[model samples]
Target: MAKELEAGFTGSPVEKPEGMRKVASDTASAIKREANAVAIGVSDHPQAAGSLVLGIGAAAFGLGYLLGRSSVSTRTRYWR
Candidate 1:
């Protein structure tokens, strides 16, 4: 195993290092554009409105749950 490993390490050719930085920069640019697009999409419509509604609803539910636990006859109090 040691002989085979030594032979493999001694025999391989080295690679060229050109354009690696350029590739990295290009990949970063693409990721930034995708993130901006997603941000714009999320900001743009009925889905955002729906998300707001859901947030409000969850908050209201939490508040109601907390208040309900502190009182007696929750259904009776809300009826009037």
Candidate 2:
């Protein structure tokens, strides 16, 4: 145990492989390209973008309200 402790661990630091780095770079480029495309689309059609956002918001709100009501009813049923 003492000898093992004295030698200690000596290893090279772990690093991301070249393949992973290339993959990450490619993914970032793709995301940037897509975002730029979306920006251009939204800029070209502001009214459509606004309506899309509002529709998403309304859908999210409705989902949340339904989930909340279902949970309340479930708890009351179990309590009785």
Candidate 3:
């Protein structure tokens, strides 16, 4: 047990890096493919995409405004 502990890892360091490189490349390619698909879909339906984006932006702005109004301190000061 002590000898094994002292020896630590027996595998080559290069193996770990090669596996990580393959994983990174696969993830990058998947993201690129999904992005291209979304771009093509948006281009095919520009009006729908624009409407959806506008609706989402408007909803976000309204939510922020309501939150800001609700958080204001409106207590009346006795001496001010």
Per-model TM-score, in order, reads 0.36, 0.69, 0.65
lDDT of 2 by residue, 3-60 (tens): 5464755885486547978799789999999999999999999999999999999999
Instruction: Name the better of 1 and 3 by TM-score.
Output: 3
Question: How would you encode candidate 1's per-residue C-alpha lDDT over 1-80 as one tens digit per residue?
Answer: 45544444664347643598668878999999999987787678768868988999999999999888888564644455
Q: Assess candidate 3 and give its lDDT.
A: 0.89
* Model 3 pairs in collision: none
Write the candidate numbers in order of decreasing lDDT: 3, 2, 1
RMSD of each: 14.4, 11.1, 11.4
| lDDT for each residue of candidate 3 in 1-80, tens digit (9 for 90 to 100) | 35535557776676444587889978999999999999999999999999999999999999999999999979967976
Choose 1 or 3, whichever is better by lDDT.
3
Clashing pairs in 1: none
Q: Give the whole-model CA lDDT for all candidates, comma-separated.
A: 0.79, 0.88, 0.89
Quote the lDDT for 75 in model 2: 45
Clashing pairs in 2: none
Best by lDDT: 3
Worst 10 residues of 2 by lDDT: 71-80
